[model samples]
Target chain A: MAKYSKFAAVGLLLAFPLLVSSDYYRHIMILALMWVVIGSSWNLLAGYTGQISFGHAIFFGVGAYSAGLCTTKLGISAWWGMLIGGPMAMLFGFVLGAICFRLRGTYFNLATLALAEILRLVAKSWVSLTEGMMGILTIQTFRSKVPYYYLAFGIAALCVFAIWAIIRSKWGYYFVAIREDQDAAEHLGISAFRYKSISLLVSSFFTGVAGAFYMNYMGFIDPDVVFSLYYISIMAILVAIIGGAGMIWGPPVGAFIMVLLQELFRSAFFGYLPKWISEAHAMAFGILVIVVIRFMANGVVGDWVKLSGLFTRQKAPIPSVTSGN
Target chain B: MEMFIQMLVAGILIGGIYALIGLGMTLIMGVMRIINLAHGQLMMVAMYITYVLYFYLGIDPYFALLVAMPALFLLGVAIQKYFLNPLLKIDSIIPQNQILMTVGVGIVLTETIRFIFRSDYKSVKTSYSSATFMIGNISWNVPMFVAFGLAVALTAGLFIFLLKTDAGKSVRATAQNKDAAMIMGINADWITQLTYGLGAAMAAAGGTLLLPIYYLFPDVGSQFTLKAFIITVLGGMGSTVGAIVGGIVLGIAETLGATYISMDLKDAFGMVIFVVVLVFMPGGLKELTKV
Candidate 1:
């Protein structure tokens, strides 16, 4: 029954491209799907492993910039740019993870966050290569959003499958066990550091791919726009909290709700209010986070799973059977 | 060479305010174990409170402290009792909910301030913004000295309050061990509320002190908060003296970096201290000093 539902869902997702019309709808779907991939991968390190990283944006920006830089300077294809993007982000992620994961808890969070800021600062000041504050404005853009949409959708689907595969494997069990209690997991012979490093690398790979997709789609890359603190906050908090973090669907759900509502919020309010008085969405975004976390901690889908009597409401069910498998 | 000394003085002075910024964050972390990312936003809010009173109401920025401090304290109490208290039940030290929720509060507060007072950078020029006092070979900006003095006073006052007052002691006790303190009749809830409120109030006061020197903006808090986090980490979380020393170190490093090196890379220098501290002396600079 579970296998049937899963296959049906994937099948429907595949068919989504044929059903959608108009560039606007496709644009939204593609961005949402790209978020789906990026968010899912993030969940592996942050959500599943219980090591909350506030700087996943670093990987994304690195991917976008690397891909952008390679394409522009070396005349590399987007395909080639993307090919290099993941490993670059992963390599950086590995270094950062290796250094910071040594710290116990709060220090680790602070370290990643600092690394993100440093990268942003570097990107901002590195005018010779990155074009500095004016940003890279002339990346190639296709008129139709269809190709980007398909690309994003394919990436998002790939991310989902990758995460699903990990979850079903022994590594996933270790990820869970380590997340739940690192000390206990270590006593049982799990090298918590190795697991975290691997997770960070994998997470960074997908994040960079998403970044490549973003620069290609937007055709612009700048520090403020691509690596803004608030954007990171929006996706990080939304995916992990709203979609029931530590699960597969968290980041995708977060991206969907955040992107859609934000679009509506921005568009509707843009012409409605005075230019100076029009910062309501920023306020609204915050209030909405508090409301969501205060109420639906298990997230929208997590809540639904509870309502449907499928998910047992405890601290995320430890896969006892999979632990020893 | 003379310019170097001047930059060094400026750096230490800047570090004073940075220490003030980290004071509340360190206290809260000691008690609550959450980094309070919105702390910088809180400083922004405090600056706005002072800005509105000074610009709109035509009140003195110093006088704005009277309104801002208590107001922010109440806000903190409400936040702690309502928003953050629930997350305390969770076992994780880095309570994800508190971090996210505070960020939300910061966004709302900043937007509200932006709505009321436009985004124009406002600084209180009380006939002393540009004033300087010269010594044998170097000069110090009067506003820098004053801001540093106030920051010192704030830290001193905080330490005194934590040590001397019964309530403050209870809050400290709660941070040490909530259950053990609760067994001795300390209301952990009350302490948490008081500590959070005190943290916000101190930030408000810090803003009042800072208004004369630093131009106020809705996002200015981000600048300080990042440094404060670095200060807190380098000093060790929950250590007031640590925050103070760490702030001074960061300030000096940033000033020298900005003067000697590229101005753009100034903030990076402070972060380098933070990174090095995190790597070498994870316990904090004090720990390394002890060894």
Candidate 2:
């Protein structure tokens, strides 16, 4: 009964906002949903598999470019563009995984960053396809934010459900085991490479679709925005760390909190601040993640669940608790 | 032939700076096994410090180094002691947590720098900052030469420090095997802190040294940081010697490749080296650590 009430409350909150939405609030919602998908996808790899990629923007760029290119150049439907983009991103993800998986520690991170930068450079220089740094203009932006809001929400829901399914399956267990101890998992007959790559593929698919979503909504696509390692990788890490990455609800919760915080700060500062402050604000967001992770360790959501268990008289069960230090 | 030689010389000069950047990273990674995304930010901060001394106080870039190094070294020590030491408590620190911790420090550092010192590009101006010497058909910039020379000097100093001092032995012992060294009455904490400070100081040195030639901005850290990382991997994760040599090779290869290969694919060429190295030999010029 309590669980049902909890669900009902959440449903009401979600439903109540949709009934009446200002353009500003609606814009915020569209962004929040978009991030939910991207952040969840990032958490899938960094949170679960323990790969710690700083190069996810490459996959996002691939999807955006592929989708954008298809629509503009070939005059293809976004439906077909998305269909092609997902596989294209997956293919790239598989190759990236296979290549960089051998590198232990920071080498992987550095290599991933380099690859993302390479993709950004490709998107910028290859004017014929990506339309250069000026980027793809005149993209299809809709009148009502409802379709975008729902599409983003649906994709995010799908990602959460997909990750949840994985958690229930052997694959998720393998990821957890390997994340804890790679050698031990290998000893236990789990192919670390295979599972890692599979998780990456799953992560990339959503990221690509999110990229497609981004191009459609923003009405402008640039190498900087699409290939922006700044947006995809750093923001994903922030969401994952803050929300207690590696758990089903981690990224979404983190994304909501972070996006909300940014909005609050940006609005609060208003015209009083300079553009540098705004850029610095993004950096501040990243710093907040680091500070929280440094101190909180298990991250915000992870800690919440842990703390809740301690206070409850009956060891109030909150599932796995995003188990961490 | 003239263009090729000029690029080669230029690459070698830039390679020296890359080596300097990689050396500090290798030193920390060898001991700590954590990636400091803040490495570049620290360097940027150091450069800004150097810039202030030079631009505001009218200190020479070389004298600014004296100020930058010690300041960064202390900042490095404090960060490691307060922030990183705690994070390194567990056996193997969580990869993502390390990312957050380092990048957290990085973002804060980068943002604070950008906040304090606007996004405008600041370069150290010496009469010699841009003065270039000509040799037959080849020209060499004084700032580049000084930076390159300093890179060599710093590497030598680091080698001597690691080899000569009692603390150096502790550092080496800890780097090789943390548990074994811990058993040997070596204070891993002290060694780790000192090593980090040393590494951070080296970055400050690089920052100040490269300030004349390279542009200083809050975001400039990302560029050198990424390049330093590539050099670190190419040379060897933990090998100091490997980093220097790898820096030169990478410098020359990419420099030459940019002209010979399509400039559009210049970055891809560097990435090609990374991918090739990872696939064929994950260690590149350096041997893999057995740990």
Best model number under DockQ: 1
Which candidate leads the pack in TM-score?
A: 1
**Model 1 - which docking category?**
medium
Question: What would the TM-score be for candidate 1 when compared with the true structure?
Answer: 0.93
Q: Residue B114 in model 1: shift from native, Å?
A: 1.9
Q: Per-prediction interface RMSD?
A: 2.6, 3.0
What C-alpha lDDT values do all the predictions have? 0.79, 0.79
Chain A TM-score compared with the true chain A, each model in order: 0.88, 0.88
Chain B TM-score of every predicted model: 0.93, 0.93
TM-score per candidate, in order? 0.93, 0.92
Off by over 4 Å in 2: A13-17, A269-279, A305-325, B90-93, B262-268, B288-291
Tens digits of per-residue lDDT, candidate 2, A1-325, equal 7469647744753673477677777778778777888888887787778888888888788887777887788887555656777778898999899888877566777778778888887778888767897888544656887777777777878888898888778888898887888899999999999999999999999888888777777767888888776677877777776777776776777887778778766665554666555655766676676566766565566667555656774563644434332
i-RMSD of model 1 (Å, 1 decimal) = 2.6
Tell me the lDDT of model 1 at A237: 54
lDDT of candidate 1 over A173-260, digit per residue (tens): 8888888799999999999999988888889999888888788888888987767777863566576567667667666777788777
Model 1 global lDDT (CA atoms, 0 to 1): 0.79
CA shift at B278, candidate 1, in angstroms? 0.6
